[model samples]
Target: MRILLLGAYGFIGLAVARRLQQAGHDIVGFGRDLDLGQRLAPDLTWTGTDLSRLSSEASWQPYLDGIDAVVNAAGALQDGARDQLAASQQRAISALIAACEARGIRTFIQISVPGADPAAKIAFLRTKGEADSALQRSALDWIILKPGLVIGANAYGGTALLRMIAAFPLVQVLAFGKSRVQTVAVDDLADAVDACLAGEVPKRATFDLLAAEPHTLRDLILKLRRWLGLPTPTATFDLPAPMASGLARLADLAGWFGWRSPLRSSALDILSRGIVGDPTPWREATGRDLVELDVLLSRLPSTRQERIFARSQLVLPGLVLTLASFWLLSGLIGLWQWREAVAILPPSISHGLAASFVILGSLADIAIGIGFLFRRWLIRAALAAIAVSLVYLAAGTVLAPSLWGDPLGPLVKILPATALAVAVMAIAEER
Candidate 1:
């Protein structure tokens, strides 16, 4: 089957795309970044489609051509000027439904979430409910999956936030941490989509894809901590709702720095409401029991690689910013204090060499700093940064040996810089 998988670079969409490909289906991916889709899923065809502009079927036609079925796994938790949930999750999805109907495509799968209702207090749930409702009203055959707390190896959004919280040395829980929640593995959720595509599940049905057992949010965090090989949080903070929301706003402000923190105000609102769901429909659809949370976590890569990826979600960004600071600061110093920057040059080197080292090297640092900000080339930039760090170490050692004994240990700092570069490279590795 030819499948058009939107959000193909996303956590769930990537898993489903892989599953569908393994099942011998040709896939065309639709997402915001085609470059990211290619790097993440090299074998799958991908196209960049701005869903906000897809106000009607005509806007979706270019993507729906030669597509036999469609899977919409794209969604958002918060609204920014650039990425509004109403467009990405609701309105554009309705447009895609219309296009699919026009193309005579009968099969569609929507990756939704629990507590999706038009009357919901949270905007995320309201938008998702609206989208799900639109799909149900469509004449095309549709399967809506409402999964609760999707757990995946590649952390993003809620999953990423969970891993980060789990990776912390200390455990922290909200005062209302007992809020009931269910978790489903990414593979399991993707498999549910595959089941729909393969005709192994009931047609035109909505199902909650979740584990057999549900746990309190606190218990879930503890389980995740154990999964990450961390001791149970000795000191857990029972954060009040108002306090947590305030902290979430701070995290939201950091979003301007390029990391979308999942602990949004709406996240707390929904968490307070709980995320449990019925699993009987899931059992009936797959003709098998859903994987329990314990089993699901056990199968994940808990060793070095997985742990690095999980912990480095926050670490990598900090490292990149730190790296950027060093480069940009160095550039500013060279441009502002060219005399002092040049004085570090060896006595044997020509004045010309010293001038080139000051100006050209500073410009290189600034350029590398700018490159680090782009996600598409982050890995490559990290690699370049590693090389640059090494070059700086070797050059400083040869040219400014006396500076090594300086109070700040400027030369000694290269060791951590190199390590940070290597770490970012490892984290950003596409594989």
Candidate 2:
């Protein structure tokens, strides 16, 4: 089979693509970033297609050619700077279904969620539900697999959040701790896709791929802690609902800046409601049980790199915020004391030249600070910070060399700030 896999570079999609390839299927991958998709799975053919832009059957034709079956793993949590849920999830699927029908391609596999409903209160679930319903009504042989919280070797979205919280030292702070969640290993989800493609599962059916039983969100975190080989925390704090909601709102605001924080309101809403579903349908169909939570965690490698990622993610937001705040304040203070800044230059320099340098440097600092607030601009911001800091250091060394050895160490402090910017640039790219 020559399969066209959408969102082929994503956590779930990549896993499925590899599984299919191992099963001797010729895989053609499609994603928003063609280069990234190719880089992630170099052996597979890849095409760049923004599903949000393909809301009509005509728009899907170019990529659908020579495709025998289609597996849609593409999805967005909510509408934000980089996503349009309705267009990508609902309208595009509808158009794809129509295109597939017109082209006489029947087999379709849809990856969905447990609580998906066309009339659901949350837009993420609603959009997904609308797409699922559309597939159900279409003439194609479609199978929908809605998995619970998917745990994998590499962390992303919900899994990343779990690892981050579990990595905290000596204390555990949790929100929606009592909410129930079933776990599904990413490999198991990939197996479900393989089953669908191999005609091992019934067509025109919906299956919830998950563990045999569910665990509380709190219990799940503890399991993650143990999985990460970390010592148990001495204290556990359950955050109040209002405080959690406030944090989620802040994450919602971050989404507009292209940061896909796991605490976004859409994610919180889903978590608060609980993630659970029956595994009986899928198990009965495949004649096998999904790996239990304990076994799932044990199978995934827990190495030094995973520990580092968890701890780093826990501090990432605060680090970015502190860096941005420092730069902004530095700029604002320089502007507020314009005369003092001008006076700091060498006595040999003209007053106008000193003032011009002060004003431009301060404004550059302000711009870099503002740039750090947007995830899309984070790399550029970090690079700019490094460049500007170097310029300041060079100018300070020539103009006021004594300041480097002064009590305040004003010129010396720039070293750490420049190093911090370089570190941010290193880890800012999202997988």
Candidate 3:
């Protein structure tokens, strides 16, 4: 079957594209990010066009010609103004439906978020709800697949959650962590899409897809921490509804004023309400058990070695040059001063201190560079680098503030070195 897949570069889109390709289906992708699409499926025929730009029905008619089906997977989870999100959805999905109808495109599969309330004020969820409603009213044979938070190997959902847990060892549990969700693997969701396209499922049907096991937010975090070999995060505290709502409102206001909120207010609200649904429809239709959270978490590549290697490669050359340059420059300056009969003792004393400083700093840099280069020594190297950088900054600020700038400047200068060390250490320790 010839399929036109919108948002074919996204987490779910890539999974679907791979599955369809394996099943011998030809795919043409329409996405804004050509590089991402190419990386996901190099062989896929891609059209780099923003769906929002194709406002008129005639503009989208060509994309529908000879296309067996249209999968509307293109939408934003973040990074948009409230009005823009709503407008983009209406323009893109509405245009696609009208064009598909005009060109005789048969199957229209609209991917939407599970448990999105039509009355919700969150722009993302509300837009999805509106798009689903629009598809329902369209004349084309459509299947609406409302999937729960998707999880997959190398995908954003699970990986992002893991990263968050890694960054923050203590997280606020929402109202004693009673809010629950069921996350589905991207591969399983893709399989359902393929089955629908194959006419194995009834038409004009809407199904909520989720994993077999439902987990509370706290449980999910703990599972992720264990998978990443990190200590289980302690629940910091829970905020009451009224307080949580106030914080959410404050975040929304901050966002409106161009301040990026670390957490999404909508996500918090969704979590509070528990965005779970009945898994009966998915289980009955797919005839497969949903993937467990542990299974999905297990698939992430142990990135410790890779990160160490990457940091080492970046730091090694610069460190080597820094050492060589400092040594040569110091000697040249010493020799020039000696010939001029400038007091060698006082100068020698200063030069000796400087040389000691340079040697120690260089050794630390080299150790860090080497540690980053070899995954095994990452932890030791990181600690050595951090210790050396802190000491060097402190001494430099005291002795030669002019050369090192203020205390903060020295700290800033050593940040890249510190980062390289930390990355190496994290990877090495994990390995």
Candidate 4:
């Protein structure tokens, strides 16, 4: 069987693609990033095309031809430009359906999130509801798989949360910490997709794919922490609804300008309600137990690799601070000596220098990030960068005391970098 998979570069999509290929099915993986596609699932055929831009029947005709089924796994997990989502889902689906129909393709599998209430206020959930509705009404034979919180080794959001708990000895509990969640493993979900494609599952049926055992958010975190050999996290405070809402609103406002706020009120609400569902259908259909959360968390790379990755993330910000310190020191020297240093440098030259610093810093950071991502060369890269950044800071302080400002200014600037460096070290040691 030939499958055209949208969002094939995503966490779930990659897992599904791998499963399909392993089962001897040919797949055409479609995504925006050819590089990510190749990196994540090198074995599969990939097409780098913006799904939303291909709105006409002709645009999708080539890909849909000879495909056995169309799997719509494309959607955003976080808030982004409204136009992008509109194009990816609304416009992309319209074109895909038309192309599939014209090419005599009949099967469509729509992967959705279970707890998405159509009338709910969250835009993400609402858009998912709309897409589910659109697929149900289409002429093609369809299977909708709405799974609960998907837990996997390569998963982003939820897996990140688990890693955080594993790294931190203590964690603050929120309102939804005790709320139940029927987490599902990515592999199990992939199996379900494969089964559906194999015609072993009912058409036009929507199944809530989840783990057989439901656990609260707190329980899940605790298990993950134990798996990573970290001390259990304790809840310190419970945020009030008004306060949470205000913070969420502030985050939404900041998001307008590209400022990301980690916590949101809608997210809190989703957590509070908890997405609980029976996994009987998924278990019966796939005949596999969901991968244990503890096992998945434990399988994460060594502490050293995590440390290197964390260190790499700081390279860009560290470079920014380092260069700013140098620039300010240069200006101060010119001011004190009444020199024409500032006037001598051309504007273009200054711009070029700044760009060069950014490029070099970014490349170094990427190298470390990749090392961290692969769980290799972490300790050496992290330790080396930490020592270098510290030396740079110390030299800047001694050579240009004025640029360092009062002790308080230097302390303030250094604290965050020091904290970040320490975090990298701590994460690396977790392994």
Candidate 5:
């Protein structure tokens, strides 16, 4: 089969594309970042396509040509600076379905969630439900596979959140700890999709692809901790619902700046409601049960790299925010006490030159801080911070070498800040 795989660069999509390719299918990958998709899977052809822009049947027609099947693995948690929920999930899906029908491409596989409903309070689920309905009503051989919290070897989305929680040292802190969640291994999901394409599963049917039993969110976290070879927590702190919601709202606000924090309100709402679905339909059809969470974890690689990734994700947000605040406040304070700032320079430099230098440096600091706050500019911000820190260190050495020996150690402090900027740049790449 020649398959057009949407979101082929994403966590799940990439896994599925590999599975289909291993099964001897020609895969054409579609994603907003064609460069990333190509880099991830160089063997496959890739097209830079944004589903949010494919809001009409005509817009989707060109992609359907010579396509034997279409697997939609793209999705967004909520509307953000880079995401449009209704447009991407609902309108684009409807348009694609219509185009598929017109182009005589009958096989369409939709990857959805467990409790998607058009009338659901959460926009993510509602949009998914609307798209699922549109596909059901169309004249194509559609298969809806709604997987529960997907557990994959690669950490992303809910999986990333789980790893972050598990990485906490000695004490476990949680929100919605008791919410029940069923999980499907990423490999199982890929296999199920392959089964659908192979006509091993029923056509035009909805199947919940998950393990037979469910685990509480707390249990899942502990399992992940064990998987990562982390020590057991000495204590557990289950945050109150109100506090959890407050944090989620803050994360939601961060979304506007293009940070796709997993703790956003949409994610919280779904997790609190519980992630579950009947796995019997898929099992009955395929005569194979999905692996249990423990088994899934055991089968996956548990190496130093995995542990580093989990711990890095847990510390990343705090690190970024702290760095931004440090730079921002430093600049603000420099501007607020212009005379004091100028006085820090040696008597050899004139007052006018000192004042001008202070102003320019503060403005540069402010720019770096502002850049750090925006996700799109994070890498550039880190780079700028490092460059400016070097410049500051060199200038301080030249103008006020005595400050290096002072108790405050102003010049000494720049070393750690510059090192931090390097660290942020190292781990900033989302993919």
Candidate 6:
């Protein structure tokens, strides 16, 4: 089939694209990032198209001229007041369904969430349900697959969160810890879509996709920890609902900067309701069971990449925050205690030069602290921090070597901090 796959570089989109390509289907990939689309399907043509830009009145006439089917997999966790979720899941979907109807293209595949309902209070699920209803209302031969928690080899938002939590050294704490979810392997979901396209499964139907087994959120996380070869958590604690909600609120604040938290308010709301689906239809349609979590885990790549990601997840934040706090405080100390800071300098270093050092060094530290929060430029920030540390180390050694042997080990600590900065720099690259 000549398919136009939206969100072609996303976690689900990548898996679906690969499965379709492996099955020898022609996939015309569309996504927010054309480079990512090209990377995901190097052999295919890619169009940089943001579904969030699509509107009900927009014309997508010619885009579907040669497409035999359309797969809508694009999504976002939070809208961030941008209305991006509605744009992608509702308006854009309605537009596409209408256009496909005009062109007499019947096959439409919708990747939906497990608990989506048009009447639901949650905007995410409501938007999904609205689109699902649209597809069903249209004359197109639509297939809707609503999967529960999707666990794939690739570590993305939710997957990354799972690994990061599982990698915790000891006690595992969470909110909504007892919520049950049935996870579906991304590959299995991809295969199901492929089967539907091949007419092996019914068209104009909806199926709830999930594995045979169900697990509580806590058990699921522990299972992942075991899969990663991490020791089982010594204990698991569910934070009070109020505390969890507070954290989610903080996450929402982070969303203002385009940084999404998998544990945001909307996400916590969804988790509280549980991520679950009936799997009987999926099994009956496929005539086989989906891959077990253990099997999927074993098939996943557990190499240096995962280990590094897990380790970095555990340490990178502490390193950045510690450095930020230290630098910001150090600058304050220098500025607030100008005389003490300057007095430590050699007599050859005039008071004017010493004041300049105190002011500029403090400002530099503050700037680097701010830079650590931006992922796009995080590597450069870490490198800049390392440079500053080395400069401080070298200058301190030359200026007053006595500080190196100080009881607090203030100067010696820079050596390790520099090393950590290097590590953070290595892991901060866009993955």
* Best-performing candidate as measured by TM-score: 2
Residue-wise lDDT of candidate 5 within 218-311, one digit each (tens)? 9999889989999889998898999999999998988999999988999989999999999988878889899999889889999999999999
Q: Which of the two, 2 or 4, has more TM-score?
A: 2
The runs of at least 3 residues in candidate 3 whose Cα sits more than 4 Å from the true structure, single-residue gaps closed, are 78-83, 157-159, 170-176, 234-236, 239-262, 298-431
Clash pairs detected, candidate 5: none
Maximum-lDDT candidate: 5
The stretch of ten residues in a row with the least summed lDDT in candidate 3 is: 339-348
TM-score of each: 0.81, 0.98, 0.67, 0.69, 0.97, 0.86
Summarize candidate 4's per-residue lDDT along 214-266 as a digit string, tens digits: 78877775675565455455543455778767866864653443322234444
What is each predicted model's overall lDDT from 0 to 1?
Answer: 0.81, 0.91, 0.65, 0.64, 0.91, 0.80
What is candidate 3's local distance difference test score?
A: 0.65
Model 1 local distance difference test score: 0.81
Q: Per-residue lDDT tens digits of candidate 3, residues 15-62? A: 898899888999999887687678767899998576667777888877
Preferred candidate (lDDT higher): 1 or 3: 1
The lDDT of model 5 is 0.91
The alpha-carbon lDDT assigned to residue 8 of candidate 4 equals 89
How many clashes (backbone atoms < 3 Å, residues ≥3 apart in a chain or on different chains) does model 4 have? 3
Clashes of 2: 0
lDDT of 3 at 347: 46
lDDT of 6 at 239: 88
- Model 5 C-alpha RMSD vs. true structure (Å) is 1.3
Candidate 6 residue 8 Cα shift, in angstroms, is: 2.2
Ranking by TM-score: 2, 5, 6, 1, 4, 3
- Residue 3 shift from truth in candidate 1, angstroms: 2.3
Better of 1 and 4 by lDDT: 1
Clash totals, every prediction: 0, 0, 1, 3, 0, 0
Worst 10 residues of 5 by lDDT: 43-52
